[model samples]
Target chain A: MAQKTYAGVTVELTDEGYLVDKNQWNKEMAVEIAQENDITLTAKHFAVIEFLRDKVEKGETLTIRAIGKSGIVDIKGFYELFPGAPLKVATKISGLSKPVSCV
Target chain B: MTEKEEYPLKKVCIICAKGNLEDVYAACVMANGAVMEGIETKVFFTFFGLDAITKKQMNHLHTATVGNPAMRMPNGWAFPSVLGMLPGVEAGVSSIMKKQMEALDIPTIPEFLEMITAGGGELYACKLATDMFKLKKEDLSDEVKDIITVGEFYGLCGGQGTQIIFT
Candidate 1:
């Protein structure tokens, strides 16, 4: 039961720093989280985020290889964008839950 | 709140020492889950676990039907050991498992490794194990980041709050 404040908004977070309530997420929060992770948000990053959100909304599993095959970015490109643990970092900034299929 | 309050774990190192389909997937699943939780994750494959990373055996991994007390049939009953001894039973069981995984949309072994690696997880092959098995770097799947010694593997886990998982 921890909280993170961003751009005048505060939200609850899990111990892992994931937003506790998806509804509490906003674009600014995404930006803030990305900055905290040493990532600068770009259209390409947003594209991956949007793809993640869309997939989550539709109840589809997300996998790195799936993203690699999606043509938005290849596996190597994903690493370049997120830099570290791409799926975890991307999902965090996307304001989405951690993907269960990541493993 | 403190940083530790926000993120309890710093890292996780998962070791895959067995090669059977069940054991290898168990390690893969756990390693992937750790990274999904935002934990820095590294997986070290050693011994028979090399089979999982080896190009020729990765996709064709077979389930260990013999002496597997936890295995169950389609009816939720204990799998018959006698049936396991019959010809083609191993392949039959392995195919069934593959089919079930496919039905669930789970990726194959190589794809799974690709997904894990692309997600920022690290994959390493054991130097001793590779040598023992006579596997060259070219024989492994592309997902393997490097062949590292056991000492080097431990060095990667040298971080505060890092957990080591062996399967």
Candidate 2:
């Protein structure tokens, strides 16, 4: 892990750029991280990010199916939001660990 | 001196030839995994595997309890193959397997296909198998892009960093 600044707040991040401490996250830092992934945070993107952060906080496993059923967005929109690797990209921007689930 | 360069996986093509629930899921899990990684993925279901794409049968597949040497009881005792012939045993085993998969968030066969396609992956059925089974286009799940010959399947598989897997 390494220290980096996002939106003027310096935080710890993994080599892959995921946050080391989710508690250090904030909306402004998330905006910078999302920009790194070429995403411009919109209301819809924030919806999915908040959903993911909430699930992680509750110690629930993340799955594409769960997000699709989250009512915030369907699976397709989720992919469009994070394109390529939805769960991995979304979690990284949301200041969570890289997802390890195969599903 | 030259430096070695890495070639990340670019595409994956998977084929499921058996209808067993385990075999079908193996193919799907691999294909979906690739899709989730943003790699191009294509899956072909043939022969008994056609059941995986069969609209009515996709969600109700069963594994082979009789011939599978690895079959075991929940308590880890060796399962007697002869008992596999008993009424309701296979169905019971299959349901248990499905439940275990659900706990891991593995999607149903239909849902797996949906997830794959939703990520821009492709699914196909084998032409010969569909003909032998007397199945029409509508008989397969809508997620299937087409019923294609093995030759046609090969046509879609050649490229750098592409792998073809058979189950």
Candidate 3:
């Protein structure tokens, strides 16, 4: 697993996808991740992250395509390859009935 | 060195008239540099200059072909007014110029206005010119601080440290 530390959060790229520590997901974390990944985090990216985090909280398996279209990832093709495993889209990973745009 | 010795000119006001893309971009680049230099800046848009500030028309600003001295076309060729009349030609030229400027990190006029305002500069519309052109406040971008008469502009330009420049 290749890993990087961003703003004290451990982000590891696994065979499954990106694994972000639950204790370290926030606006600062998002900015750090974007910066580390060389992606420009625009206002639209923030909107999508909030939306995806809500979905993760509700226990829905977020489609990689959906995540890409949501505007968070500047490179969608890489994310599109991982469609199976319950990808950890949010830091506070929990099981729920559905996905909400935010907490 | 003391603050006074480190920096001198306090304010600069620029007047822009409608012209070719190079001229318009040159005007914007000058204003941006002045703002970066910590000088208070004002850009007053009048007549065809309004195209550089209006939202819908801003992206299509072009360089003057007939009498402009700084214009150069592809392969050392000069662009003729007849070719400029073709549909989308002006926009193509504008886009090319914008790409070149972006490569050089010079902000577009709208972006330049945002930079200026963020840096404590002011942007205004020429009231008389606006009325004569039948343009309303809504015709301009939301960043414009206000519309003022030429006399009012002069009032803002007053003081020994202020320099007014026409582009």
Q: Candidate 1 regions off by >4 Å?
A: A1-38, A83-85, A97-102, B1-7
TM-score between candidate 3 and the true structure = 0.56
- Full ranking by DockQ: 2, 1, 3
TM-score for chain B of all predictions: 0.92, 0.97, 0.84
lDDT of 1 by residue, B61-146 (tens): 99877788888898999998888888889888999999998777667788778767766789999999999999999999888999
Which residue pairs in model 2 clash with each other? none
Q: Which portions of model 2 show Cα errors greater than 4 Å?
A: B1-4
Candidate that scores best on DockQ: 2
Model 1 pairs whose backbones collide: A15-B6, A86-B119, A103-B32
Model 2 interface RMSD, one decimal: 0.7
lDDT of 2 by residue, B7-72 (tens): 999999999999999999999999999998999999999999999999889989998889889999
Candidate 3 per-residue C-alpha lDDT over B8-50 given as tens digits, one digit per residue, 9 for 90 to 100: 7888899987645665676676675565455678888887887
Of the two candidates 1 and 2, the one with more favorable DockQ, higher being better, is 2
- Looking at the true structure's interface, with contacts defined as alpha carbon pairs within 8 Å between chains A and B, what fraction does model 1 recover? 0.44
lDDT per residue, candidate 3, A5-98, as tens digits? Answer: 6568666644433543443455766666555444555665555566666766676555433454455552223222221111333222221122
Better of 1 and 3 by lDDT: 1
lDDT of 1 by residue, A1-103 (tens): 7987976788888877888787788888899999999999999988988888888888888877568777899877887899757888898888787666643
